[model samples]
Target: MRAYLALLEELERRRRGNSLAVYKPYDRQAEFHAAGATNRERLFMAGNQLGKTRAGGAEWAMHLTGRYPDWWVGKVFDQPVRLWAAGVTGEGTRDNPQRVLVGPPQQQGEWGTGMIPADAIADTVMGRGAPGALDSVVVRWGGGGDVQAGESVLSFKSYEKGREKWQGETLHGVWFDEEPPLDIYSEGLTRTNATDGITIVTFTPLLGMSDVVLRFLSAEAIQGLGSSPPQGGVAA
Candidate 1:
């Protein structure tokens, strides 16, 4: 009985300490990851609090660290990537996507307990203005052999900052945690256009058929969504 209890405790410890080690995406998550290969811009539209944000975080973690699960079949970056993960405000980002990727904002000691493994977390730079918010993270990318220094950077941004903040930098990818205004969304897409990088947006339909939502609900995309359950992502 003692051994069994000890084993259970250890498993729980591992699960919390390095959540990424046990990450197993559901059917929809796998489908979303796989869809990234063909679709440059994909929208994961689902109900709020339904793991859409979690999916985005998991994929972002994989890309930033260049550490993909053996069963992963989604988009894979050959080298370490420069990516952005954003939400509505500093607090919203800190509470959701940021937490998902880097663990609890309040608990700096448990930083790597999120989707990105602890050892792979190279460093974190605190963002300005926002209290207890992270500006960016340096992840050790296990970019095998040919790839350089093996480090990738993940930056945090907010839609409230406007589209200009999103300009300038050429990104490997962008993950939008919630529905962004059309213009902001366009700017994000442009950032990746030069590199042929991907743009992934995961959000609920709060805008109710707004431009951003409409873009993903094209005739074909709508048809795809209706016909049987999609594994992940609908091309737009």
Candidate 2:
């Protein structure tokens, strides 16, 4: 009897823990960029802690788990997606992008507490690099009563692995949590070309006028820049 009560309490806690309110964009800019983005390639470039990474991570969670909120107006996939989330190095990728997508690297028990709801997490494959980091995660689609629902895969990648490592696989989406080199970025672009897949980048423009930054800037300029960084806008 005691065990049964404990189980019920645990389940209740998880139910309340997965509320969408925990992950909503903090401002209009974040809301617009995360849900309003229509471009095939989108860049959320801003200064530190302005919710750039948070917006990107939230959108990616929606895409991967197929659990979009009612307010979502961004790109939607009819089927399960295969995505790559990348960063500057193995440790950085694990600590930042991977952490945002699936929770803390060192805390396996806390895996489902990030942007991904606890119930949507299907399984995780452990990676060899960076202690307790994940190589990939499988997200269970709620199906929403549609026939296309299933498990979506999120793979962890590193820019330090080079352009060659980015080659070959055809992906549904790619999220770069940091500005990647031109060659690596180009390789990522190629992987998504066949599927008309989307590429989302979230970064601080600390590199100033680098090639990757210039690509987004040349087409459309970032707006409303202030001391604290643009909250959550996207430039494509």
Candidate 3:
């Protein structure tokens, strides 16, 4: 029947959308994500719309849910992790990091269609002040025959909330989807110090030569590196 065929098509689309096997990162993205294994700090500076956020989001999903693909050569956490993903403001955070990690913020049922696999999403807590935005997400780990292993946590944050908001919690990782103020950036680093956790910053260098940007550039210069410090970018 016509209706039955339509339904089948929809189901197929959802199946493809939820599968991590469909993700194929380009060479630069692969290197960026892989650096987390040895680097405590990383910066993915690129032009706009070059898939920087997408690459970062996918890696965060893997860390939070322990759902790395067999081809994954990135950082692997032995246990469930507590991570924070942030942007410049509440709305920006929801639109960028939240959308990439989960799904469209305005869509209710399509939440698990993003980089995070549907089966790995355990639950979500709605954030304050932003409608349809998630305050945090709980991800189920250990899918290889041990579904009861543990749960990882991913929290959404914003730089507009100030450095004070970034304080008080020791986290396993932090993903900055936009350029953060220096104070906010410093606080985020401090939060992960106890865990020796990683901080991944993915942003276009619109605010050219800011302290955070300079920090990475300076490091590269001091080390006389051929590649960009932390990771380089590809053209959009």
Candidate 4:
């Protein structure tokens, strides 16, 4: 059928690295639903093991690398862009979304084969394995100073800090992982108004009545929610 043929073509395009990772219908819908509106805030709610973290990680990776593919606007980041990639805490960044960003070994089915490899990324964002490369691929930035890597330097922070040190700074992008508190998200967003970049918060909605839950459930926000069989044989 024509639909299946189109799907195959798109898959081939992705294989050739000509497109961003393909989202499921619901995920794709959520992206469009959030992008179309002008709301300063948007949220995606779903059960665990869903692609919420994937969506955010993918977008953040692309934007930081200045590699905005189709269906994404406002992602052309300025060089050495100030970025803060955070989770529940520093260790959490070493987990979910950050793990994806850094290219840990494939986890069977959770990420499928679509996840980007750490090596495949340009030297600007990740790093090239030179003769004297560091032990790990981790790059550091921040604390009233900055790192001048070819790619944007993203400092990892914890949601527990609230608005304390996160305020009174300018940023080009901010990514919050796994249900960061609403106040932290708000404060992070304040730092991300450089030119016209974006602030991304990605998480599966666990608690039913949180402010984030309300934000996405509100009539105007994109609504993507449901349950699916676990991927990678893991509950996520």
Q: Please give the RMSD to the true structure for each candidate, in Å.
A: 3.8, 3.8, 3.8, 10.6
Highest TM-score scorer: 3
Residue-wise C-alpha lDDT for candidate 1, range 1-236, written one tens digit per residue: 99999999988767776777777777777788888877888888777667898888888988988777888877888888899999989888888889999999988988888998887899999988567799999999884666665889999999999988988999999888888999989999899987889989987766655678667666876565564443434444
Candidate 4: tens digits of C-alpha lDDT, residues 129-178: 22221112222212223534454555566676567957887877677777
Task: Tell me how many residue pairs clash in candidate 3.
Answer: 1
Write down the RMSD of candidate 1 (Cα, Å).
3.8
Q: Distance (Å) between predicted and true CA of 129, model 2?
A: 1.2
Q: Candidate 4 at 14: error in angstroms? A: 14
lDDT over C-alpha atoms for residue 91 of model 4: 55
TM-score-best of 1 and 2: 1
Where does candidate 2 clash, by residue pair? none
Q: Name model 1 segments beyond 4 Å from true.
A: 1-13, 143-149, 220-236
C-alpha lDDT score of every prediction, in listed order: 0.83, 0.78, 0.83, 0.52
lDDT of 3 by residue, 21-108 (tens): 4778888888887777678888888777888999988889888877788888768888989999999989999999999888899997
**TM-score of model 2 relative to the true fold?**
0.85
TM-score order, best first, reads: 3, 1, 2, 4
Candidate 2 Cα misplacement greater than 4 A, ranges:
1-12, 15-21, 28-37, 219-233
Clashing pairs in 4: 110-232
Model 4 quality (TM-score): 0.59
TM-scores of all predicted structures: 0.87, 0.85, 0.88, 0.59
